[model samples]
Target: MLLDALLFQLGYNAALVMIGAGLLGLAAGMAGTFLFLRKRALVSDAISHATLPGIAVAFIVMEAFGGDGRSLAGLLIGAICASALGLAAVTYLGNRTRLSEDAAIGAVLSVFFGFGIVLLTVIQAFGYGRQSGLEGFLLGSTAGMLRSDATLIAVSAALTCAIVLLMRRPLTVAAFDPGFARVSGQRPDWAEAVLMAVVLAVTVVGLKVVGLILIVALLIIPPVAARFWSDQSTHVLWISSIIGGLAGYFGAALSAIAPDLPTGPIIVLCAFGLFLVSFLFAPERGVLASVLRHFRFRRDVHMRQGLLALAQGHPIFEDLTLKLLIRAGFASADGVPTDTGRARAAKALRDEARWREVRGDPAFERAAARYDGLTDLSDVLTEDQLREVDARIGPPVGAA
Candidate 1:
């Protein structure tokens, strides 16, 4: 009875955590799709680090404004301010300097983080009675969040979701073909700026559950995994959101059960694990699919080489001699290609009998060549390509 009651209560708490994480995950996934498409994935990481300065400034501002020792509103405003500054810096560096986009991101990330660290040290030295709680923002701990914090996250998530849905068509056009979008009067520049703002907002909300240091993992891993499962943008968005939200809820629950475990690391691990699975086995993009494709191509190359070899000599009237076909791995010593080894090789192509059947045709006579490891389409060819190939064979003997 006691265990049952405990299970019941755990389920209830899990539901609450899931609700908040679900909202946050949906926003992160939608915004992250565009980020990945735009090749601006690292921008999220830069903004997350930049928030440190904002948190420090928020604390300083809260003390000046005189209300509570800590102020969520101040933190939000300060973080947004710092994020805007970082964005401007990245833009300036990319436009005015020779730095690449990633380089600009790295530079801004390091400089702003260094400044935040200095501010942090100063706060500690002054020995303020109030705890800064800034460290929690670094790696995240859901235990530090309350009902009010959840409410803020929920509201931010709703705004992000609304904006993304409304801007879907323009964003898709810009991502797939920016030049075309611009020519069509889509105004991709303003769309890009608005998209970045949504990313920033989502990052801010994530800070409470996953922290600034690890939040980018949430934004990146889910979409990466989702891409392996679906090519369509809409399916990718929904699947990624589901995957991300599940990871967050499980990470939080695990931390709740084992008080020593950190929420941020656990959540990141969950998302990364899913990415690995997707990369290895997600249908079309999986490791298995690529290997199969390579095997099929190699087999086709070998068969085409064999056909060219026979054509160079003369067209055979009937089936290939057992010796010749066996040597080609299409038959056995008994003039039959039924051995398991031969079957395996044939399967790698199409079928063993099928190749022999094609070999008997007079037309197949010209298909074979000297087997010098290239297709020998000497007789059957396109006029334009044939002229190019014949020219490459070099000038007629006396013409040289």
Candidate 2:
């Protein structure tokens, strides 16, 4: 069943759903990157919740006017308007009041969402036509959706992605450095408004598929997971889009296989799965790589400490340190130094003495900072510098 759905054999509606959702994810991921960089992720949440009132209000107004209350275009427009109002309120409070942006966001999100709920209740009480589906916008519903609606979502998503691409440079500049962006002929406020507009578009479009509640996850999870794969913003942005697209395609397919499950949550779960994989196994930043680096560091530290202990003729008591010495052929099982062990120990002792002298002289402060007890002095200082430091130590004890 899963294979059939994944292969697009589940039927036309399933295929349409998958394609539309894939486009949505791709756009959301890219837009979400700007939102993430903007450090205003909470703003997306506020906008999404704020949109709900617009949807409900649009429905009520349309019903009163004898128009189709469930019109996608009307609902989305209402959502956009409400989102804009919410953004304005957030901006006003942030700029004028002592309250922080987060606090303003929290207030707007609660009020707008609560008002939406009240409107929904009033619609139900008034016994509106086919008003049952209105609640689906809270969590999303693809079942029994009209072909026209799916097409609209797909087209909107594609257009949103195109718009975002065209404005990428300015959005990025504004997100990271508003002051620099202003100097570069970009109005920081307008660039930021553009970013909010993109996010608002994504949220409004997503309401029919992922719903207002889960839409924020679609906007955030992909970029966060992509960040683990690369340090560069460009790489992260592309990777995030790919990840979002894959999640949407597979999540829609998976949801199709089990009609009882909702597509929004399934898509979110798919994104989280990607995040978990990246966290545990990404090349440079994963838990497995961190563990490997830690083990390697420990080995080096043990070997260095064991060698020095042998040089000072101190008893090797630590089990790991003694085992390391024996494994490296630096000491016998009895903890006595081999000839090679003696040579290494001598070098370790001489390096320690050099570090001691370097630490005492303020002139070598920068060079001395390189001493981590595991590093070789030769690695930190040039030959001439090493020769100068060594001259201070003189010849060996049996010197002629």
lDDT: which candidate is best?
2
Model 2, residue pairs in steric clash = none
Query: Which TM-score value belongs to model 2?
Result: 0.89
Query: Distance (Å) between predicted and true CA of 226, model 1?
Result: 1.5
lDDT, candidate 2, at 226:
90
**lDDT (10s digit) by residue, model 2, range 155-255:** 99999899888888888889878899999887888878778888998899989888898899999998989988999878888888888888888888888
lDDT per residue (tens digit) for residues 53-163 in model 1: 988888887876785536676787888899888888888998899999889999999999899999888878887778777777788776656667777877788788899
Q: Considering summed lDDT, which 10 consecutive residues are worst modelled in model 2? A: 391-400
Each candidate's number of clashing pairs is 7, 0
lDDT of each: 0.72, 0.88
TM-score of each: 0.75, 0.89
